[model samples]
Target: MGIVWRAARLVERRPQTATASSLVFVVPGWPGHLPGQHVDVRLTADDGYQTVRSYSLAAPGDGDRIELGVQVVPDGEVSPYLAHDLPPGSDVEVRGPLGSWFVRRPDQTEPVLLVAGGSGVVPLAAMIRARSRTGTHSPFYLLYSARSPDEVWYRDHLANPDPQVDVRIVYTQQAPPGSTRRPGRVTRGDLDKQAAQLQPDSPVYVCGPTGFVESVSNLLIDMGWNPAAIRTERFG
Candidate 1:
């Protein structure tokens, strides 16, 4: 069946990082979605003006509940509302569980490499959660890049011990005290090191802003990773 717009109630909200928050909604009859899917959220003002924005699902759910991690964009419309103004128990319009290419299937046994920049980690987080929920032993590595330790979404949750998932945080602007690496963008060396942990045929999914996605995807191609094996989704 085609996806439809439905009214969803904001049931819970939690702060993920300094600039991001995780919003959970209760949607009745939310046809189950796969990891890496996104939904379009629509908001309306009292004057009947409306705006819509798409957000990736942060975790896989059993068709009744969905989570989205929204980063407050400076001077943004929807994001600011989602991050701060919206209150629990408020109603929002949602449409989707969309996109098909970037999704991860549970039966696949190959290693998975997920790379994210800034808020782009949202969909990748769904894939990671799905892997854990299904009890898949496939080695999964997440290379997440943010401005600093404080800006990394789900930092505490990513800290939770999971032998199957290996997370590496790359700080671009600032690094915590005593950190060995200098603050910088993710380098070819970083990708090389993580790629070594997975097989040559392993699928790589990269998500982030346009420039970040372009740079990473090009680097993966230059690294001899098969172009077809690298799936990318760009936002902003």
Candidate 2:
């Protein structure tokens, strides 16, 4: 069956960072979504021009309420509206909860590794939330890279200090004052240390800009992780 576009009302908005915000919608009859799935959003202008974009679900939720974390793009057609202009109670068209290749199912019990860059952490965050929500103790580790500490999304949520989910932050451009780690991209050494924590069969999910995803995925392959066990999703 074709997925129908439904009007979702914006029920709440929470700021995650200076440029990113989490938008929650009340969608009646929303089909449940697995962690790492995304939704296609469409916005129409007054003159009838419309634009569509895809954003990952940021958290696991009941089928009725959907959440998306939007990062404002300087010249983007849709994201600007979503991040800055749209008011509460506004209605927008959404279709999806889509894509299968990148999902993390509830039944997955093996160790899991997630790597993210910039705003690409969206879906990976969903996977973490799903793991916690399902009460799975299978080890999960996240190595997230961003330009600086302020640009990191969901900082507090990631700071939960849960022993079951380990999150390591890497700053590519700048680090906060007094930070111990030098500012740089994710290196082979970083991956090696984290990879040692996982079983050989652990499922690895990498999401980020095309270049970042490619670099990390290649590193994992070089580290002898199975290509079949690695899943990736790339964004701008």
Q: What is the TM-score of each candidate against the true structure?
A: 0.97, 0.96
All candidates' lDDT scores?
0.89, 0.89
Worst lDDT 10-window in candidate 1: 193-202
Which pairs in model 1 have colliding backbones? none
Task: Estimate the lDDT of model 1.
Answer: 0.89
Q: Write the per-residue lDDT of candidate 2 for residues 55-114, one digit (tens) a residue.
A: 999998777899998999888777878987799999999998899999998888888899
> Residue 12, candidate 1: how far off, in angstroms?
0.5
Can you tell me which runs of candidate 1 are displaced by over 4 Å?
Answer: none
RMSD of each: 1.1, 1.1
What's the distance in Å from true for residue 109, model 2?
Answer: 1.2
